[model samples]
Target: MEEIFDECWNSKGIQVFVKRDDLIHPIISGNKWRKLKNYIQTFSLNEHSGILSFGGAYSNHLFALAFVGHSLRIPTVGIVRGEELIITSNPYLNQMNDWGMRLHFVARSLYRDKEIPSEYENYLCIPEGGYGSQAIDGMDNLVHELPSCDAIYCAIGTGATAIGIARATSVLVTGILTLNNRAEIEDHLKDFPAANLKLDDKYIFGKYAKSNADLETFCRDFYEKHQIAIEPIYTGRMFYALVDHIKNGHIAPDSKLVAIHTGGIK
Candidate 1:
């Protein structure tokens, strides 16, 4: 888990150091690996029984959980948000199904609270993005990877990673919100003891995982310029925002910024 801090001297004279968390692990890496580590350690997982929970479709957590649970010989279940959709062309859902995760799709509204039926109460339910106390414990340990940094920047999804990092580290954190639900994020972060948490509302391209031509171009140019691959869902937007913030002189030149690259480049 060595953090890469190499400076890329590009042709355009733009210098950037890439922390390649994408190379963390083949099946489980980045934030997902760190978040799941404690859960696997603390819980006594049997040969064919464990509960993993997440959204209906396009959930990175569900995908990662299915992969890890299967590898560890634990039978997993994904408590998805929203009613079941028609069985058609859905790559994400189909992939999870192939991975042997029991997909349970409930009403979108109820999925938020995750009040499961009485019959299934015994299962070890892992919340979306593995939030709650367990996730905080795992993320708090992530500081061991980077003991010293002036600031940390990570993409904001459910705010789990941000909250965990903010809770774990004393360094200033810049969480780039990637969705329109700012109020929800603020509400979530309120639970943490905030000493260095700084939420920025500028990077969310008006929607979650939605990108305009400029963003797309930035993604393309970023790869072409630095050979660092970033997904549009999380890391791409955060990296772009970081570059923008630097260009705007928001971060001092002397201050070292460590961008947490949670691998989602699928």
Candidate 2:
């Protein structure tokens, strides 16, 4: 946890600190590792052949999986979404291929169903973005590591990280939605206490991974002033929402907040 003293928030009498989960690893950083850790640990007990997962061409999940598979000598397979894409489609795709993950691209329609090939059925297949109960344990682990604060904020992608934190802790968890999946997130988190988690979609700007000039500028100024690395896709939107809330007086004065930095591997 790193406390950042910004004059804007400081002047407003709000305190901000960053939980650098990105420092967990270079590739399998932040929630990536947290969400996948359980699956990897129990792989040996299962009768599956290897670890297989689904993702896009530039998926950080597949990228991290490939590296983990390489380092641990565990066989891995990636089901890419776009049929037109291949190992050479992007540098990250190329790297995943080079790390020994067998890549198979399929039609987007079929990818939406997340179906594994009959041949790979024996492989332990994880859902897209690691959206399952497996991630809850990992997020619980993260909750144990966090400091006490009035509220905690994190970016919402698959909703696993935020939901897990919300379920495990009484601290207010605000998940800034990066994608238009509020309904899905609400559905998944319906069983948890509603007050523990709050979903905010105002910072999405347009949609997942979409960014404008203002967001880019904020990221640049953030790095310049705070010396913390953030991208517009995930952590940037989350932190931006935090500051915006502070400035907008959404938070009470003298309140301290924790913003999770959910790393970038793409």
Candidate of highest TM-score? 2
Model 2, residue 54: displacement in angstroms? 1.0
TM-score of 1: 0.87
Best by lDDT: 2
Clashes of each: 0, 0
Give the alpha carbon lDDT tens digit for every residue of 32-113 in model 2: 9999999999888259778999988878899999998999888899999999997898999999999999999999998889
TM-score of 2: 0.96
Which pairs clash (backbone N, Cα, C closer than 3 Å) in model 2? none
Residue by residue across 63-182, what tens digits does model 1's lDDT show? Answer: 788888778777788877768653243777777777787787788888878776665566687878877767766776666676466788888887888888888878898889888877
- Give the residue spans of candidate 2 off by over 4 A: 191-194
Work out the TM-score per prediction.
0.87, 0.96
Error of 1 at 99 (Å): 1.7
Which consecutive 10 residues in model 1 have the weakest lDDT in total?
3-12
